[model samples]
Target: TQASYETTSVYGHGHPLYYNNVINCLRGEAEPETDGREGLKSLELLIAMYLSARDGRRVSLPLEY
Candidate 1:
């Protein structure tokens, strides 16, 4: 059986809330409730992953990227 708490957390709350937040932010109806730095960090991680795969070496991402 699926864990009740996990299912509720994701389907009932997490997904809808995050979706609404993104929609609202895109429409300029509300300020983002999440930290903008986290999005930047995710982008940095993606770039690092791509660079590492392309160059065949470990890559350290810069904070400004």
Candidate 2:
């Protein structure tokens, strides 16, 4: 899993800024810069895709509950 770690590290996928932001937050030098909206969107999309595949229908984004 070294490759996976490297791919997610400060030098890969252009995630350095986000990584540094997290480090700074951990060090109490700054607050977390991300509000997690992007992560929520990604999770929503994944769930929609899973639902669509499971139910054999087109699933919509921002799924209504």
**Local distance difference test scores for all models:** 0.79, 0.81
Model 1 misplaced stretches (Cα beyond 4 Å): 2-17, 25-31, 63-65
**lDDT tens string, model 2, 9-56?**
555775677788899998999998667897788779999999999999
Sequence-dependent TM-score of model 2: 0.52
On the 0 to 100 scale, the lDDT of residue 22 in model 2 is 91
**What digit string (tens of lDDT, one per residue) describes model 1 on residues 1-65?**
75555454535757688789999999999888777788778778988898889999988767344
The TM-scores, one per candidate, come to 0.51, 0.52
Residue 17 C-alpha lDDT in model 1: 80
Instruction: For candidate 1, list the clashing residue pairs, or say none.
Output: none
- Ten contiguous residues minimizing lDDT sum, candidate 1: 2-11
